[model samples]
Target: YANSTASGGRRAHVFNCHTDLYLEEAERHGWLIQIKSMIDLFDEGWTLRSIRKRLKKDPTCTIDSLGSPSDRDITPLRQGPPQDELPDFTLDEMHRQIVKFIVVDDQAINLIECPEFRRLIRLLRPELNDADICHRTKLRELILNAF
Candidate 1:
């Protein structure tokens, strides 16, 4: 029942998952495991392309070689400690964020419409009408670096 209300805007988060264990758990927990389109993944709050890119970039998390059409059960490939921390991630959510990143990188970083950035700039600079472009740019870079 989401509408165009401001509060209804997306809340993006960066998430990583035990892709293999995740799909398996889907069957266990009865979460939706139906094959979905890349766009569906993005709509689910993920960057489908980024998921692929992440798997390619890092081998340990590549759940499946092919996209949604592939029915093969993905093998678990955890390399370190078991992924149990609750930093804010689910298997589907992980896919969503990665799919979102494919289309939008800022949203992937959870920086879209950041309140802190807006508050900081208003509090520190207050006004930057082309006069403090260089200073503002450097300051912005510094803030990003702090993250």
Candidate 2:
């Protein structure tokens, strides 16, 4: 079992295959109802089939799968006052940040070529296409133009 607490103090308990069977047994004994009342929580669209599919794909996957906890731990399934929508940054703003990282932080211009980095960018800006991602040459040009 894995427990996660959201920023809003909402706690989610994720049970593995073994714990899932235990929950079934507990429900048979009328314990699940009591547990549910105490937690004031219900399912958030995760069905057994979906869980199995996830487990099949990634045996170590967590239900609160946001990203690696090293980067950020976001609980998208929490119940609370809806999170404020983040203001969208324009393409220029994104390019500026990239340039800043490359120039100020001495980040490699080729960092954008990393698959994980590209995946993160896609996740953050789903509307952008592959062509929209600036390559190392474009980054070099951007640095030259900025200076």
Candidate 3:
């Protein structure tokens, strides 16, 4: 009864997709697909056992089943391990390493000439044509010398 009103002892809430409020609500609580899945399950008349089995298989398929967020004060999620911390490499050092890594494979040079990849680049920024990327990378040595 997702898109239904409550006439027989049930409550009803309205959601307007046209507004940013709908987007915020969905974003605030992650698992955008779960909402649609639940609606579809309701429409298909899924049993509680079937729903439980599906939820067990994919844990992210349900909301916080034990309690709602409002039921308790929230705590910050855990951070990564100490080893996961950022390295202390300098910008220039990182740049040099990146360039070395890229140039190791000559195939990367051919990637610059790819039509589909060039289309993607142009789509990202229409002002930046295929020649822009190809010329920039190819003429890097000269450009760096000029700088």
Candidate 4:
């Protein structure tokens, strides 16, 4: 037995909605739809897998695979990568290139928008050696705004 019972007034670990499961459950009852990756669900909240699951009456959000509430009750997760772990931007005049990359590559822009990215720049500010401070500033500003 699945420890769950008929949906009407049944208290169980999970529900067996039996139809349009995802769409109907959230429509009728309180759904704790947890978002896992903002990037994954950027344009649309539902994916192909989610859509298929919805057809099977699994419309509500995935029960967070994350563990007990108290487990996360201790502290919020950190926002970005560690400060010290960024790659050394050591190639001669690489600042110009990285700034150019920031303007163009969406992925690079995502990385640069990170607070860690911001921090890395600040950390290495003294060592930047003035390849082109104006260009670097413009690039940083562009990245931050796009973020």
Report the number of the highest-TM-score candidate: 2
TM-score of each: 0.19, 0.39, 0.23, 0.21
* Candidate 2: tens digits of C-alpha lDDT, residues 113-147: 88899889889889987778888898889966864
State the weakest 10-residue window (summed lDDT) of model 3: 5-14
Model 1 off-target regions past 4 Å?
Answer: 1-15, 33-147
Residue pairs with backbone overlap in model 2: none
For candidate 4, the C-alpha RMSD (Å) to the true structure equals 17.2
* Ten contiguous residues with the weakest lDDT in model 1: 7-16
The global C-alpha lDDT for each of the candidates, from Candidate 1 onward, is 0.36, 0.50, 0.37, 0.37
* Local accuracy of candidate 4 as per-residue lDDT tens digits, 1-147: 111212223212223333234324433332222223322331234432343343444434343321223222222221222346556565534544464444322233345445666566657666643333434355667545532
Sorted on TM-score, highest at the top, how do the candidates line up? 2, 3, 4, 1
**Model 1 lDDT per residue over 1-147, tens place:** 012223123311112244544334333433332233323544434443345455666676443333442222233221122446644644344334333332222222333235664455346445532332223344335434432
* True lDDT of residue 115, candidate 3: 81
The better candidate by TM-score, 1 or 4, is: 4
Point out where model 3 deviates above 4 Å: 1-101, 104-107, 135-147
- Choose the strongest candidate by lDDT: 2
List where candidate 2 sits over 4 angstroms from the true fold.
1-88
Report the alpha-carbon TM-score of model 3 versus the true structure.
Answer: 0.23
Taking all chains together, the TM-score of candidate 4 against the true structure is: 0.21
lDDT of 1: 0.36
Range of the 10 consecutive residues with the lowest summed lDDT in candidate 2: 1-10
